[model samples]
Target: AQSPLALRQNILSTLGRTMLEEGVWTFPFTRWIKLIASELSAYRDAAPPDEQQSLRYLTPQDIHEEIKHSGLLRYGDTRTRVEFAHHTYQEFYAALALKNQVDDIEPYVDTPEARRRWQGVIVLLYGITTDRVKLYSQILGYSNDYARIWLAAQCLANAGEDIPTALSRLQEALVPSQQFALLFSVGLACRQLGRYPEALTYLLKAAEENPASAEVQFELGALYRQVDQFERAIFHLEEAIRLRSDFVDVYNQLGLTYYDQEKYEEALTVFRATTQLEPHNPYHYYNVGTVQKILRDYEGARESFRMALKLKPDYIEAKTQLDMLEKALSTGVVQMLEKIPMLSKMTLEQSVLLANRIQVKEYQPGQIVFHMGEMGDTFYIIEVGEVEVLAPEMGRSSGGVINRLGPGNFFGEIALLRAVPRTATIRATKPTRLLAISRDDFSAVLSRYPAIAHRLAETSSLRLLRDRQIGRRVDLDRYYDPGYIAELTRQDRVTVLMGDIHGSTYLTNAIGPELMVAFLDEYLLRMSSIIVQAGGAMDKSLGDSVMGVFGSNPDVPGDESLPVKAALLAALRMREEYVILRDKWKQQSPEFAHSGMGIGISTGKVRTGTVGAEATMVGPAVNMASKLSKLAIKGRTESEVYIDGVTRQLAGDSFATEPLDPAYTKKKVGVELEAYRLIRQK
Candidate 1:
C-alpha cells in the first residue's frame, strides 16, 4: 500500500515533535516502548493476512515479554496486572495532559517504560480516566473484540483511577458480575474521601452483589461506629469476630463499645479476656481497674490499679485511683484513732494491724468536697490540707468559717444516720489531704467504743440543726407529716389573718403610682421583718396581702418557745416603722394620712394551696382572714388587730380577750362564727 515508506517518515516526524515538546519523547520510557510494540503485535496476531498487512512486522513473543517487564503481570493476578496496565497507560497519561503542568515526566507521570508495555492495554480498553473524550477516541482506534477491550477497562479501575469513568467503561463493557469487586473498591475510596452518605449507597449495592465479602463487613462496621450506631456496630463487629477471632484490635473495640453503654460488668469481662489474650497491654488492666472501682470492689479495684501502676507507673488515671484508695484507708484509721488517739503509747506492731486497714486522700484546690444538705456517708480527718466552710443563705450570707484541718480534727461523723445531709459545704482551699472513714468502719469503731458514737451523734445533730436554722428553707416535716395533712378536715378550727393597706387603689392613683409602689415596698418589708422576728414564716406575698406562718416547722430544734414572742415583736416593730413612714408620706401627699391598713389576726386550722377556677383559689385560712380584714376596715379601729378565741388561748393569760356579740358578726354557712378582740394587759 506504499505505507512502509510513508510510515517510516511519519514515525520519525512524530518522534521529533514529541521530543521537542517534552525535551524527551512523550513516551520515551522502556515500558512505553514495550506497550506500543505489544499492541502492534497483538493486532497482527488477531488479523487475517489482508488485515494483518496493516502492521504485520511485530512478533507475539516480543509482546508477551513486554507485558511481563512492566511489573503489571509479575504477580500473575489478573485483576491487579490488568489494573496496573490500564492506569499506567490510559488514565495516568490523560490526567497528566489534562493538568497542563508537567515539568519532569520521570517523577510527575508514569515512566515511559510502563507506557511502552501497557500502550496495547489502553488500546484494548476504554473509560479509565475522567477524560471520557480521550478514552473514547483511544478505544475507537483499537481492535474491537469485546473481551480484551473490557479486561483493559477493569485493569484501570484496580489502579485507583477515576471512578465515574471506570464505572462508565464497565457499563459499556457489560460485565456487571465481574465488576463487583471494582465497585466495592470504588465505594471504599469514596468513604475514605469523606463522602459517607454517597459511599453508603454504593457500598450497599456492592454488598448486595457480593454478600459474603469480609472486607465489606469491616467497612460497614467502621461506618456504623463513626455514626455512633452502637447496636449496629455490635452486630457487624460480632460477625467480623466470628469470621476472625484473632482480631485483637476488634476485641479492644468491642470492649470500648460495652464501656460506652455503661455495661460495666460486661465491659469488665470483655476487657479481662482481651488482657489475657494480650498480656502486655497496660490499657486493658487500667480499664479493668476502672470497672472494679465502679462495682465498689475496693480490694479488687486496688489490686487491679496496682497492676496498672506497676505496668505504667506514670499513668495519671492509675495514680488518681491509688490516691482515692489511700484516702479511704486513712478515713478508717481516723475513726479507729479517735477512740484511741492515746494509742501513741502502744507498740508499733499493735498499731500496724489497725493502721493497715486505714486509707488517706488528698484534694486539689477548687475541688468541692461536699455540698450542703448532701448525705454525709463518710467523714474525713485532715492529714495535710485546708478546707473552707460557707454559710447557706440565699445570696448574702455571713457565718463562721473553718480555716485548717490537721491530723487530729475529724469531720462528717454525723453521716452515720441515713437522714443527715452535710452540715456545711466544704471545698479544698489548697492541695489538701484527708484520712477518710466510711460509715461501716465508723460502725466498727463504735462497737469498740460505744460512747464515742452516741457523743458524736449528739454533738453533730446539735451543730447540724443550728446550721439548718442559720439559713435554710422551712422544714415542714418538723410541724406535720403527710398523715397530719391528709387527716386535717374542714371542721378543724385554725384561724389565720391576712391584711393589706386599705384604700390602696385610691392611694396609688393619687400618689402618682410610683411613690405608692415605694410606700408599699417599705411597708411589706417592715411587716415581713416583724413576722420573721416573731418566729413566724413569711408564707406568700401578693401585691398587697401578707401571709405568715406562726407554727409551720415546729420540730426544727431550738427556739421552740420563741414563735409567739417573735410574732408580737413583729407587730410592735411594724407599728413603730409605720408611724415614721406615714408621717413622711403625709408631707408628700394628702393620700398618705388618709390611707390606713386592714389588720386581721386569727388562729384556726385551714386547708391551703390552689382551689377554684384553674385550681387557683386558696382555702379557708385566706377566706377567713379576708373577712376579718374587711371587718377591721369597717370598725373605725386604728391599726385594727383581731384574733379569734383559739388565738387568745395560744397567746396565754398576759392578753385580754372579749367575745364580739353575735349581732356584730356576719353569718357564714347559716351560723355566726364567734370572734374576739385582743390586747395586752394594761
Candidate 2:
C-alpha cells in the first residue's frame, strides 16, 4: 500500500544498487536476465499438475527483439544489471521459454553433472523434478520403462520417498549382470532403515551382479558387521579394500569389526596398518593405540598415542592414554620396527633409528604419487594397498598400467641413489600407504649396510630392465574407423606420431633383398603393435615411415589430452620395439646392423574426415610430426624422439628436455619450427 511517489523512489534506489553491483566487472546483463527467465519458465510450466500456465516464448536469440519492442524490461547503461523496469514485467512475458521436452530421460539422468547443469536449480529447490515423476509415472503405464526406470529409481533415492514402489519398478527394468546401480542404492537404503536381512539380500544380489563395485562391497561388509557376521564382513571388506585402496572409512570399519570379535591382535594389526595408510588421521593412530594397549604391546601403544597427539595436540583421549603408556615405557617395550621387511635385515639399533624417521605417506585411488621426469629425493616402500607403474612411451603415457606393486615392495630408489629424474609415473590404484625415506637418510644408512646397499642396486637394475621391456603387442582392429564415410567434416583436434626407419636403405643394400624383406616385415609388425596398443589409430605405412592418428573423433565428449598422450606413448613404444628388432636382425644377419628408428609427435587442430573410400586426417599436426620425425632421423647413432611446443605444453610438467636448434620444414616457406628432443620419459 505504498503511494506512487514512494514506489518511484524505491525503484530508483534498486536501479542504483544494481548498477553499482554489476559495474565492477561487466557481463551482458540483458542477455543473462533473458536466459535466466527462459530457463525459469521451462521449470515452472513443466510442473506435473498440468497445463494452466502460459508463457510468451522467446528463443535466446529473440531476447534482443523482445526487449526492443517491449516496454516492461528496460536496457540500462551497458554496465547496469538487467532488470524488469516494471514490477509485473516477468509475470507477463514468462510464457516465452518452453524447450521441446525430451521423450527419453535416460540420457539426461544417466550423467549426474549434465543433469545438474540442466535441472540443478529446480532440483535444489524441489529435490525432485515433479514433472519427471509425472513423466516417469506415465511411462510406467506403458509396457516397460527399460533403462529409463533405473534413472527414475536414482532420482527416487534422492527424493527419499516412494522408494519401495521405485525399487519394484527398478527390479523389473534391470537386465542380467553387473550393471544394476539401483540395487546398490536400494540395498544401502534398506540398511539405513535398519532392515538388516533385507539389506543383506539386496547387497548380496548386487555383489553377485556387479562384483567390481567397491561401494557395494563396502556396504555389504558394513551390513555384515552390523549383524555380527565377522567372517562374511571381513571377506567383503577386504574385497572392498582391494578394489579401492584409499576408501579410508572401510579400513576403520574393518578394524572395528576385528575389535568387536575380540580378535585383539588382528585388530591391532589392522589399526596399525590404517595409521600408516592415513597418518594424519588422529583417530587412526588412536585406534591403533587402543588395540595395542588391549594386546599389552605397551611400547607400540605409547608410540601410537604419541603420534596421535603429534597430529592433534588437543586430543584428550590420546593424551590420557599416552600418560598411562609413558609409565609402562619405563620398563622398555618392543617396537614394531623389526617387522618392516626392508629394515628386518638391518641391525636392531639401525632399524630403530631409521624407523623413527620413517614417515607414512598415503594416496587415494588413481592419485599420482610422482609423475615421470620429476626430481627424486625420496624412496618409497609400500606399507599397505597397491600402486600401478605407468611408463610414458613416445612423448606421452599410453594410459595403461605397466606393472603393479603391493606391500613390502619399493620404488624410486634408482632415481634417488643415481641422482637422476623419476623414470616413470607411479599412481595409486587403491588406497595405499607408503613409507618414504629421504635420499640423504637412505644413503647414510646404506653406507653402514653394505649388503642391503648391494641388494638395492640389484633390485633397481632389474626393475629398470623390466621397465624397458614392458611394452607388449597391440592389436590394431580396435581403433581404426575403416567404415568412415561422408562430406560432413568437422574441425578435429589431433595428435600425430610419425616414425621413419633410420637406416632402411643401408640395411637393404647390405643384406640384399631376401634378408632385408624379412627385417622390414618384422619391423612393421612390431611398430604397428606398439602404435595400436598405445591407443593410436593406424593411419598408414609409407614405404619406410609410419603415421598414426589420435583424437579422430574430437567432437565426442572425452579427455582433450588423450590424443596427444596416446600419440606420444605409441611413438616411444615403437622406438623401443625397433631397437629390439634391430638387435635381433644384427645377430641373425651381421651385414645389416645399421637399423634404427626416429619418432616425432605433435598436436593441433584441422578439418578431417573420409574422402570417398579413402580416410584422411591431413593438417598441420600431421605435417609437423612428419617433418619432426625426419629431423629425428638425422641422428645417425641413436634412435631419437622430438616433440613440438604444443605437445610439450600439454604433456604437463616433468620432462627431461634439451632444446633443439630452430629448424625449417620444407613445406613452410619462411617460418622456422621450434622443437625439443624428448630424450626419454624421465
Candidate 3:
C-alpha cells in the first residue's frame, strides 16, 4: 500500500501536467483525456527503449477506468467537465506547478481579486518551495496593497520558517498607519502556528497601537488560553466582550476557559447568557446544559438539553443526554424524596408510601409554574434549583421577586390543605425540579396520620398571612394616586430619553438585594419626578433603566424645539440628582462611590401606542436612545448625558455641547450617529 502523501503527490503530478499546459484547472471530460494522452505520449517517445517498456502508459480506455476509481477528481455541474474533488487539491497542484516558475505568481497576488483567487496556492507555495527568499521578496515588493503584504507575512509565519527578518523588512516598508494591520496579521499567524509567547508579544504591540480593537483583544485572549494563562485569557476575553457585546465567539471562549478552571458556576452563567443572546442556536443551549450538569443542577441540565433538542430535532447528543437524565430522575425520585426533612418525620414504611405517591415535574428558567388566583390541588417540594414567589401585581417580567426558594424548600402547602386559591405566583428563576403530591394523596396520608394535618394547618396559616403582607407591599395602587390613562395615539416626532444606573451589577453584588432595591427605589423616584416635571411622559422602568418620551402627549401641541429642550432639561436634572444620590450613598459605603448614571436623548418620529394592555413607544428613536445610554456608560467614567445630532440641532445654542470623537463614536455606536455631550444651558 502506498502512503497517503505519496499517492497524493502521484495524483497531482498526473493531473498537474495537463492543468499547467492548458492553463486551466477545469476542462471538459474528452478534452481532459486528450491532454493527458498527449502529455503521456510525448514522455513515452522521449524515454529510452528499455525504460519506455517499463513505463506503463495508460490509454484512453485506461484513463477512463482511472477516473472512475480515483477519488481525487470529480465531474463538475456538467458531467462533461472534470475538476479536482476539493479546492485544496487544485491549490496544492497549482502551487507545485508554480514552484520553479516563481515569476509567474505575481499576477495572482497584485490585486484583490487575484489574491482572493490564488491566496491558498500562494500560502501552500510558501510552505513547500525551497526558494523562500525569492517568494518573500516578491510579495513585499507589492507594497501598494497592504493586504498583499499582510498576506505574505501570514504565509511566512504559517510556513513555520524564521520570519523576523522578513517581518522587519515588511514593517519598515509600510507607513505608520498600516503597521497595526501587519502586526495583527503576523500575531494571528503566529498563534495559528502554536507560537504562543511570540504571538503574545506581537499582539500586545498591536493592541497598544489600537487599544479599542475587539479583534486584537480576542486574539490575545485566545493566545493566552493556548499558554494555560487562564486569568489573562479571561481578562482579555471579557474586555473583548465589553467592547463588542454581540461577539458570540468571544463568549464561547470565555466560557470554555472558565470550564477548564473548574469554575462551573461561572461557566454556567456565561453559557446561560449566550443562550439569551442567541436563543435559536442549539449549540448554545447544549453548552449551557453541559455546565449545569457538572454543577449538579440535574433538572436545569435536563431542561436545557430538551430545549436544544426542540430547536434541532436531529441533535443526537442532546437526545442522548435527555434520555439519560430522564432515566436517572425516574429511578432516583424515591430516594431523593426520602432524604427530605419533611418526609423524615414519617416512619420508613410511611416514607416509602408517600414517596411512591409523589411525581416529579421540571420547569425551565422563567417558566411560570403557577399563577396567583389559580385553584391549586398539589403540594410541591423543591428537589433542585430555585423558584421565585411573586405577588399578583408584580407579574412575571417586573420586579416581582419577593421570595426565592431553593433545593430542600417547599411551597403550595397552603393551597393543598385549605382548598383555596394560590395566594401568589410561582416562577422558576432557574431550571427547577419539584416533587408534587395531589390533594387526594395528602388527604389519604393525613387520614393515616392526623398529627401531620395539624402541623400543615399551622404552617399554612403563617404562609397565608405572609403572602397577604407581600401583596400589600408590592401593590402599586396603594402607594400612588390614580392618574388618567393616556389615550393610545401616534406622534409624528418625539424626543425619547433613556437613562440607566452604571455599575448596577457591582452595586447589587456589594450591597445585597434589600439595599439594592432601596437604592433603585430612591433613584427611580427622583428621576421619574424630573421627567414628569419637564412635560415628558414616563414610558417604562426596566430594572435599572428608565425611558421617557417628550412631545408624546396629544393634548399638548408645541414647536419641535420645545420637546428637545424639555428632554435635555430632564436629562441635566437627572444627572445632577444622581450626583447627589451617589455622594450620599458613598458616605454609607465605599462601593457606591464608583456608581454613576448615563443618559441618552434622541429626537425623531415615533409611534406611541398601546401593545396589548401596556403602553409603549416604538421607533428608531427609542432604540437609539437605549443604545446611546449603554454607550454613554461604556464610554465615560462619570455621570454623562449624550444626545443625537437631531436633538442638538433643534436645541440650537440653548444648551452648551461638545461633539464626540467621530472615530470613537463610530466604534462604540456601530452606526453613523453624530452625538454630542450635553454640557449645560448656555
The segments of candidate 3 whose C-alpha lies over 4 angstroms from its true place after superposition are 1-31, 35-90, 97-122, 128-154, 173-178, 311-314, 333-682
Clashes of each: 41, 16, 0
The candidate that achieves the highest lDDT relative to the unseen native structure = 3
Candidate 2: where is the Cα deviation over 4 Å? Answer: 1-127, 131-162, 171-179, 242-248, 314-316, 323-682
Query: In order, what lDDT does every prediction score?
Result: 0.53, 0.60, 0.72
Q: Name every residue pair that clashes in candidate 3.
A: none
What TM-score fits each model? 0.37, 0.30, 0.38
Please write out the lDDT profile of model 1 over residues 1-682, one tens digit for every residue: 2223332222322333333344332343454344445545544566578866755554433443454464533322432222224334333443434233332332311434444544443433333344543443233223322333333334454455566775676556644444555456556656665777766777677667767655555566677777778888777767767776766666767777777787778878877877788777777788887777666555787888888888888989888877776565554552345343223222222333335545678799979888764666776767676876543322122323423444555566445434344545778888988767576764665566655456655554444434332222222112223343333323344334465666677776776533554355446545654554454555545566665545434345544323443444444445455666677567557667766665556555656465332212256555666666555524332455555555656666655656776666655213466666554442
**Lowest summed lDDT over 10 consecutive residues: which window, candidate 1?**
471-480
Model with the higher TM-score, candidate 1 or 3:
3
N/CA/C clash count, model 3: 0
Writing each residue's lDDT as its tens digit, candidate 3 over 512-619 gives 543455456456656765776677777656578888777745567556588789999889988887897787666546788868898999888777455576556677
lDDT of 2 by residue, 203-270 (tens): 78877877787777887888899999899999999999999998887888898999999888888777
Full ranking by TM-score: 3, 1, 2
Query: Between prediction 1 and prediction 3, which has the larger lDDT?
Result: 3
Cα distance off (Å), candidate 2, residue 658? 99
